[model samples]
Target: MTHTTHTTRTTGHVAAPRPDVYRALLDPAAIPRWRVPAGMSCRVHTFEPHEGGAFRVSLTYDDPASTSGKSTARTDTYHGRFTRLVPDGEVVEEMEFETEDPAFQGLMTITTTLTDAPGGGTDVSVLHTGLPEAVAPADNETGMRMALDNLARLLEHPG
Candidate 1:
């Protein structure tokens, strides 16, 4: 079957405990730091880390010329609800782009799961599904990878 929408999964291991990793993912202040893509900045307008809670965020590209199918210009805004949250285990959010563009018509769910690594640390897997037709799966994977890398760094070496 031919797929029309994008879906991506990225995995990584962080040299930190699951509780620590979970806190960073759900923390309002830390969310903007690690969730942003490598060349972009994330602004959190509102965040409440609990099931049925809502959050709003905007990501702006560093290069104003850069354009994604979801955003013709610079910034892409989103508002989503926390569908599920499990302490030190998992988080699921149902999100929708805040735009009238056809590409941003559907709701997307992002799930992040955490588990203990074989030797130590924590294993994190992120799955993003229901991406619109305009978004590319490869790009999403790359961005997720970057975010995971940042999470590793942030957890292993706190400033």
Candidate 2:
């Protein structure tokens, strides 16, 4: 089993916000808002924000006729157990994606850490492990960056 790993980090200017606000990231309702670019949409089939809960989301480009909207760009149907939830500070999720696609079929764990900065902002770091060699490092890096960017935007403007 070839193993690969990826790590990404992002820092926001605003204070670390509330733990509850960070926790909102796991919610299905809030996922679509930040899972992708503003024009894309996300649909969650199951999202239980707790230890051993399962989560799945389908990210679809809004314009079906557009080149980007040929099909669901990605359907993350994965099972994960929240190994640890440190309120606003950190979340460690152990997950495995079920896929026949050679590029992304493997067991993976993602640990997301949030630290409070001096200006009440938060610094987020994500460490991904157990990726298959078939998956490119750049792709993971780009995806994580987009996801974190989305999270930052969501926290900045709460509904």
By TM-score, the best candidate is 1
Please provide, for model 1 over 1-159, each residue's C-alpha lDDT reduced to its tens digit, 9 standing for 90 to 100.
333677888999999999999999989999888988888898899999999999998899888778662544788888999999999999999998877777666889999999999999999999998988877788888988999999999999999
| Candidate 2: tens digits of C-alpha lDDT, residues 53-119 | 7776565555656543212243445556677777777777776665666556666777777777666
State model 2's lDDT.
0.64
Tell me the deviation in Å of residue 47 in model 2. Answer: 1.2
Candidate 2 clashes between residue pairs 3 or more apart in a chain or in different chains: 14-121, 15-120, 15-121, 16-120
Error of 1 at 15 (Å): 0.5
Pairs clashing in candidate 1?
none
lDDT of each: 0.89, 0.64
TM-score of each: 0.93, 0.76
lDDT value for candidate 1?
A: 0.89
* Alpha-carbon deviation at 130 in model 1, angstroms: 0.7
